[model samples]
Target: MASIDLAIAGLAIGAIAALSGIGLLVTYRTNGVLNLAQGGIATLIAYVYREMAVVWGLPVWLSAVLALAVLSPGIGVLLERLVFRPLARRRASAAESLVASLGVMVLTLGMCAGIWGLGAQTDTPAVFPNKSVGIGGHHVGVDTISTLIVILVACVSLGLLQSRTKFGRQMRAVVDDRQLAELSSVPADRVAAAGWAFGTTLAGFTGILLAPRVSLSPYSLSLVVLETFAVVVAARLVSLPAAVFAGLAIGILQSELTQFTVNGSLADIYRTLGSNLFVVVLLVLLLAIPNLRELGDAGSAGSFSSRGGQEDTGTVAERSKDLVWRVAGFVMLLAPMLFAPSDLRHAFMVPALALIFLSIVIVTGYSGQVSLGVAGYAGLGALFSLKLASGGMVGIPHLPGLLAILVGAILVAPIGLVTGYPAIRRRGLTLALVTFAVGAVVSRFVFEQPSLAGNLTVNPLYIGGWELGDKSFYVIELLGLGLGMLAVRNLHRGRLGRALLAVRDNTGGAAAVGVDVRNLKLLAFTMSSVVAGLGGALLAYSASSFSSDTFQPIQSLLWFTAVVVFGADSAVGAIVGAAFIVAIDVMAPSGSSTLAVGILALALGWLPGGLASAVRGVIRYVAEQLADQFVAPASPIRGISALAPAALPAGPGAVAPSSVGTKPAVASARASGSTAGVAAADRVAADRGLALTPFGRTLLGLVGGGGTARPTPAPARANGAGPGAAGDIDRHATVGAGDFGSRNHVEGGHR
Candidate 1:
């Protein structure tokens, strides 16, 4: 009977989970967005509701109507119209849309934090009071019954609407082929808008109901909602009923598990699992699921517009010369080491965190794949190192840090491969959800498990015969980062680099060329995860401890956005990105880094390929300008021959003298020199062709060789100079040296 009561009590939580899952599925189905913002939105609305009812003195029902019915849905519709519509129209990659969703999540969280502060709100208004009714020796709370009823209603109504209504058919058509549906005249936008509104309303309702059961703090509530993602994944982002069932089973199972008695370590493990079983389930489901319905053509192509379309006009040799610039950027990273001792100590986080973000760059940037589960890999890396060092398992005693890192990397590689399998067929919002679900699972089950992670201790990496201090450890980090950059460079060059680029650009096209897309994708994921694990090991040592909060799933989201904004494919960019995040946190307020990242990520459309790409462009442009100036012809000789001796040498030699020719001869000698000067002037004019406008060319003719003189046909035609014999001589004298003279003349010298 007591067991039955606990099960009943669990059902209430299950019902709420089911409601959240159902809401997520609806949004994915109708609008094809997984709504990673769901949790953030829910938390935000809950706070709003609490403020309206508890502080603003609004009636409970009125507050609920305003929040759930008006404000929440209104927010969703506004986002769809303003933010998502433009993205959809431009056909943004799924990874980009996922970033946009993260942006929304960050924005909402910041807004909540700004409004209500980070403190917990325990006095949240509950829809149903603490009252119970007894049925067949089992007492159930009214809220529990109401929650179950609400879940049933939502499920049935959604199922009916999707399967039966005209609107449902149109939605299905649009989801199937948006362009085709538009040809069929279905109002896809209106249908999508309706879906967003409906999904958001459900989120608001779920938040209000769940708030009373859990403390209402922005992070905690949001995380709780995230944990329920297991329910959504179990449904494959499709069926409401399936999600509802998964939620209920997880809730009831968790409650039932509490009654079991066990030994201390095992008991702690069980308790943790009991509370977070859904997260474990979610992770397993995400990794195990074969395929998911993708949103549009997202995740199928590389996110960069300049990827293939832009010629590598910048050659590998040319690009390598830019390595000096990258070294300069790296030097900037080390600048902090020169700061005050206290600040220098904090700067150690830059390299360690940069290594972690480089993992993101390798997997997402280089491969054109999206990974939001990096934190999971990092946490696992930390966990493995701790466990190996402490010798927790049988027959395995404490190990050295270097050995622990190798083992940790090896362990994480398989996990990456496992996750990569799902990624091959899933993309965009589907992949984002899947990866996020995996992170949540690792966080709840592995990180939170006392038996696994609670008592684990991390040891420092050792080299031959020396213990590392903070500065020495930083040096080690630098070496690791150097190796990481080498690996990334290798990945981005040669056959492997081309193959990854091929896969990223066009999977089908790449496979057609026998590129083995699947193997390459798996290889990238494995390598990336191993690097991430090493970074995680470093991060643990830097902190000198392992805490669950250090590897929260939200951190993964933040890391992903940072890498994307910094330039996904650039290792140097990854380092700069890490430094930027660390510097912001050190210099500004705590949450300001996220705020800055959010704003920059929102500007992704304008800054294409992120800030790294923009910086590369600026550098490239400057380099080109410098190259042009270095190779450009020396300035045209002007106003120099005017001060020269008359009848200058025709071609660097004295003119011949003749008697009949002497009189007419010196006349022709002078004429020949003028023609020579005019021809030189023409050559100079053509050399400056790039700078000349049609108007400038006309002006050049008006400033003809010399004033008030004309050259006759003999020498003038021979030199390809027209009928301005005297004018040509005057122009030559007006300019330095003859127009056709050698370029090595003085600024105003005719010699």
Candidate 2:
């Protein structure tokens, strides 16, 4: 009977969870995006409501109406028009959409942190009074009753809207085939905009109701909203009824579990499980479920890092710029060392963060796994290293710093493989959800567990039988980073690299071609975990302590978004992203880096393959200009008698050199030091050939020698000055260097 009271008390939480899930389902069904930003949207609106109602002293009802009726939905429309519309028009894959969603999430968190500050606000205005009334000898809160009504009304309204309306059919059509719907004049964009509006409206409602229940803070409130994802995942991301039922049942069960009492670690584990049942269920459901009714291609995991049909090896011009990029990146990395002692201490985090970012590069970039759990592995690395160094683990002796880190990283490799087994048959958003679930589970079950992570401490690490200073430790960090880079390079090169690429590009084709797809995926996961573990260990060492909050589940989203914005596949991008994060955090306000990353990620539509690819394109253009400075044009020139008849373009479009009224006698004068003959050829060129067509001008720009002059015919050369003479043009050997940024390898080889 007491359990009934607790279950009733839990109704308020269940109702809001239901709304969150239903909102996610509506957006995904209509727009084919998982709306990873749903939680952030909710958090942002919550802050807005608090500001309007509490801070500004507006009436609660007015604040709620303005927030839900206007501001929240406006954000949805703005996001649709600004961030997502271009991607949808271009038919961006789920992986790309997922990154954009993360961008929104990061942007909203940044906005909240920037404005409200991160302190917990217990003064969130509640729409309903805090008092409860008796119902048949049981107490029920006004908030719970109001939420129950809202959930029921919201669900029934949505069901009718999605079924009994023309807009509903349009939504389904757009989701089924947006381009085809547009061809049929179905107003797909409008339908998508409507879907986003409706979804975000529900998100706002949930946030308004939820703010009073939880402490209003940027990260905590958003994380609470994310935890509700179990509702939709349990619904198989399709059925609204299933989501509602699952939400209520989980909520009640969690509430009911409080009655049970036991002792020992098993009892402690059970209690923790009850509190985090949503995360546990999410992980189980993701693993147990065979397949979801996802909208994108099954092998679309590599789509975010897609090279946009560009070749992997690229033009010779592109290759030439690599050395320059490499040098600049090296300088960027080393600049931190010359900083003042305090600044250098802060910069220790740069290399450590780079290693973690590199792990993401290996897993998501090289293999297209779309892992959002590298933070989980990284956290494990930190814990394992600390445990090893402190001799906290059973039957294990304390080791030196470097050795413990290595062993801890080695131990974490198998764990990554074990966790990644689910990825053996998953990709794209489905795989992303699976990895995120695994991460959430690990965070709750391991890192947050008091027995494992409580009051942990270790001595300063010694290197080579001596304790090192700050600068020396930084050098050690650099060495570790170099080793990690070498490993990434090896993974991205040779037969193994090609095989991983094959798996990423097309798993079925790779299997057809006899590539062991499963083994390669497992290898990628193992290697990625190793790198993350190393980085996580270094991260702990830098702080001289292990802290669970540092590796929160939300950190994974931030790191993944940053890596993709900087170029997921390039190791150099990881270093730059690390530098950017550390630098931005150091120089500016706390959340400024997050805001910048969010802006850059949202702009990923124009900057395909992220900043790294954009930079490479620019360098390739400059390289082409340099090549043009030296190499002669590859195409034939007319109106020059030094050129043989065979050298002229033979097509009908070709104009006869004789039409320009130029004579053959100009050949000798043009080929030698005679100024008069050169003038005659220049006159003809100025009248006709000097004014190049667009294609010819572009070719000349890329390969610059002898604009209108051609190599003298063998007989004509014999009659003129020797090859060493002043007017003699040495034949340009670089014939095919005209096309700048030309792709040289197979198109779209997993980027």
Candidate 3:
């Protein structure tokens, strides 16, 4: 009977996970977005529902309807229309859309915190009445029964909707080819909107159901939704039944694992696993899954967004200028040592964090791989450094900080290789999600476990008898930072850079060029992790303590956003961004920096290339201005000089009598050079001002006047139109109200 009760309890939790998984899958299948905002959306709706039912004293049903039916779906439509639609219109890569989704997540969480605060909301009223029922000779909670029914209804309804209705057919058609569907007169926008609505509604339902099982804190709630990724990954983002079954299986298995008992340290390990079974399920499933069923075009370059910087194809002389700029930037970093002791201590965080961001730049910016698990690697480095310094190894005694950092980095490299192997075939959002899952699991199972990381401490490096002070320590950090920057610069130059660029630009092309992409990816992951480990060691030493919060999964998200905001590919930008973040936190109230960064990341679509890249663009433009000022202008009259000596002589000799019909001609000739130049400039200015040309004006008039201007026929052809056009017009009809079939002609005509 006890076993049956536990099984029921586990199944109830699984049922909720099944709900969240189905929501994620449906959104992905229909819109081709993995919806990283699922947790945020869930958290928002749960809070709203709580506010309505408990705080505002609304009826349970009314609150549920308002929260689930209106607020949740509205959020979906809002995100689709605002954040996602622009990216989709631009055909932004899956990776960009993934980051945007993360932005939405970060934005919503910030809003929740600003509005509701981060404290646990124990008063979150459950809509389902607290009642029990007799089920096969055992008592069952009403909430559990309700959750099961909701899950079943959603699954069956979605399955039927997808397999049956015209809506489903249209959705699949749109998913296959959005432009093609539009050409066929299918309502692509409406279908996408419907998908968002349904997906978000399911999210709300799951959130409400799960709220009763745990205290409602932002972090805990978000983590719960993330752990459910195990089910979604198990489904491969395709099978509805599979996701549900996987969820239930994990829940039940987790419950069953609690029955076992072990002695000594093994017991502590069991307890950790038992409490964090869902996280374990997530990590295991992500690593075990061979490949994800990613949506839309698989070959689409969705992961690494091009920052639109001009490719540097300049000579060695020009390249030397770039080297000078880099050197100046390094000098600027070193200038911080002049600050007071307190300020210098704060500056120490910059190099440490900069090294961490540089790792992201290498893995994400250079190679177009998205990793959200760098925090996990960093945390491990700190732990390993502590272990080495504590003389905890079987044979080794306590080591100095420098030796410990080296050993920690070497120890951490294999962890990266292990994770990177799974990442060989994965890219974009799938890779990001998988890495995030790994980070979350590590946080819960290792970092948070008292038996593992609770006693971590930092040991300062001593040189002879001189212990490094804050100023000296900051200098040492800068040296490590410099080494990291040098390594990154090497990766970004020469043959290695070309190989990485080739891989980033096109994997197939890179392979065709004889690049070993798999090995390159693994190599990048290994090196990046090593650098990140070194950074993490410095971060721990700077703090003089180790806390699990330092490497929370969400911190990885913030760090990634900060890197992207500062221009992901720029090492100097990474350093600047780290300083910016640290400065923001020091100067502003807590969480303000997150809010500011979140806002900036949300607006990254319009800015393009991020704040760092934008600054670089400005600097380059200024330098170009100065260079142009130093160059002499060419003689404007030189082209005519070669042919015009005789002409000038003839004109001087013939200020001569104008012919009878030559009055207008003489005036026009007199208008040559200065007058003509002025007229021509006026015309050019007008064209620029109006943004139009003669041909453009004519086309605009034709289009505005509602006339379908027929194409002029070739002189050889009797009729202007091609054969079979009249008969097959409907068959070859294009999407949109305009003649999409003739888009090239329209575009060329406009140009």
Maximum-TM-score candidate: 2
Residue pairs with clashing backbones, model 2: none
**What lDDT would each prediction earn against the true structure?**
0.71, 0.76, 0.71
TM-scores for all candidates: the values are 0.76, 0.84, 0.80
Q: Write the per-residue lDDT of candidate 2 for residues 133-239, one digit (tens) a residue.
A: 89998998888888778778878987897799988788889999999999999998889898899889988888888898889988888878888988998898889
lDDT, model 2, position 483:
96
lDDT of 1 by residue, 576-632 (tens): 888888888888665677778877776775566787667767776787788788877
lDDT of model 3, residue 92: 63
Q: Please write out the lDDT profile of model 3 over residues 1-751, one tens digit for every residue.
A: 3778778878878888888998998888888888877887898889889998888999988999999888988988988887777776766667677778777777777767767877888887777888889989888888878888888888899888988998889889988888788899999887888888889999888888777678876667877887788888888888999999999988888877777778998787788787778778777776777667777755333234333522222234325435534665576578778888888777778899999999998898788788888899888888888888888655778788788887987788999898888778777656777788888877877888888887776767787878888888888888889889998988877557746755765566455435688998998898889889889888988888888988888788888888887777777778877888788877865566666777878776765657755665566677778778996753332212212222321233332111101233332343354677544433332222111111111211112111212222112111222432211111111111122222322211121
lDDT of candidate 3?
0.71
Model 1 residue 357 lDDT score: 92
Worst 10 residues of 1 by lDDT: 693-702
Instruction: Write the candidate numbers in order of decreasing TM-score.
Output: 2, 3, 1
Comparing 1 and 2 on TM-score, the stronger one: 2
